[model samples]
Target: MLITPDISTLSYKRQLAKRFDRASRSYDSYADFQKIVLDRLLAMLPLSQADVVLDLGTGTGQALGILSQQLKPKCNIALDLSPQMLTVARERFSALPNLHCVCADAERLPFQEKSCDLVFSSLAVQWCLSPLDLFNELFRVTKPGGYVVFSTLSQGSMPEISQAWVGLDSQRHVHDYMAQDALLDCIKASGLNLLSSQLSDILMWFDSPEAAIYSLKKVGASLIAGDAHSSVSPTRWKAFLREYEKQRDERGVPLSYQVSFIVAQRPAIV
Candidate 1:
């Protein structure tokens, strides 16, 4: 069974949005991991034209150019929870005539049913309070025979960080990720037909444990309001660093990410 955190509170969501908003300026630089996953996710997308494309959590509009180049959508919708992030994304893609950026929640997308021909999200669904709700929204917005491709962090991500927090206090320090089975169950229940799915263990090497944590913060991924206590004492922080050093390899500290990529489609009208 997967133990997930309760991040459904509006306050937590607002905090998360604020964190991303603050990181908007530096997100592109520190999002190396996200860029890698985005490339992999983009490669997995079947080479088919889409008249309308929706990029959920389209941080800084990274996918806009690529989607335009590959899928050649007539219209592109970039939606995000953070207005500041969307502001940056809009600026980044201002030259694109067909691009539209919207500030909206992934769980409650402000789009009509069957309004999109393709829905793509990268490294975004893991932050949702209920992945099922997001999946359902994706399914609802997708046209018949349309596709939904997404990547999310699975249960084994950031094992070293979690390990380092052990022996300190019982309070959680890292966010909880959904187990693969639990995620699959949600996908199955969402009624979208699974076309392809893959799980990968990608290790990102950092110069130090602090650097790894810093990178996460730079990318707006270090939000801990859901499962972690607000404060960590200086002594506890030092202890965590010492514990984290024990797991360092020759390449430096290893941050293991269990990434899941899934491609699903709504059934075509028969």
Candidate 2:
């Protein structure tokens, strides 16, 4: 069944694609953090025998490689929205016969319904223009008794910078993540019966605010719906830095991220 997606839900994803497409040339340097997160996510998943796994937003094929080695799925479809990102993924996984890269939207997935045993998405779904619709699409493709595992930042993500920015200036650069309770509600509404979910408050320390912003851009995360080119005056930047510094911990400035991990199952009858 073809699903027509609402553009509002994919607005952030379009912005992030621009960010990632621009950063693809330099993404490898900062991808280690993503790898760590991927490892943590993988440890939580349990795969069935030769099960087909759909890796949504599989940037650079690293996630596919990891899944292939760990889950040994019979076939892996690595789908990403950015052509540049998929190019990187295709190059990296060229030798892996099991992995195939396709450029497609996550919300309106171009795959057979109820054909996949598992649908795994990482940091990607947070950027879904319409998370509810995306989850619904995920539920559509997953076979009965199949699993859906995903991770995304919560509302508290980047509080230090967001709070400071509001005080220093009215510019909002951080994207708004779904709240834990709200996100769970969306998942449930999509018909994926929740098995378990863990919402954790995580913080990432950075040497400087510029470094933090740079890392965000490097990871293709700078596009916060309306944040195009924030032309802040020097005075505003200074004020912003001062407010941001207030949120610093003993180690250094902290980027607050409330992360949620979910493991849900599609009903066997569905």
Itemize residue pairs with steric clashes in candidate 1.
none
User: Model 1 over residues 1-270: C-alpha lDDT tens digits?
Assistant: 854445556777798899899999999998889999999999998657999999999988888889988888999999999999999999988888699898988988889999999999998899898889888999999999999999999987888888888888897677789999999889889889999999999989999888888778887888366323237777877888889899988899988899999999999999
lDDT of 2 by residue, 157-184 (tens): 8777777777455656677788899999
**What is the Å distance of residue 261 in model 2 from its true position?**
0.5
Return the TM-score for candidate 1, rounded to 2 decimals: 0.94
Please name the candidate that would achieve the greatest TM-score relative to the true structure.
Answer: 1
Question: TM-scores of the models, in the given order?
Answer: 0.94, 0.90
TM-score (C-alpha) between model 2 and the true structure: 0.90
lDDT of each model, Cα atoms only? 0.87, 0.78
- lDDT value for candidate 2? 0.78
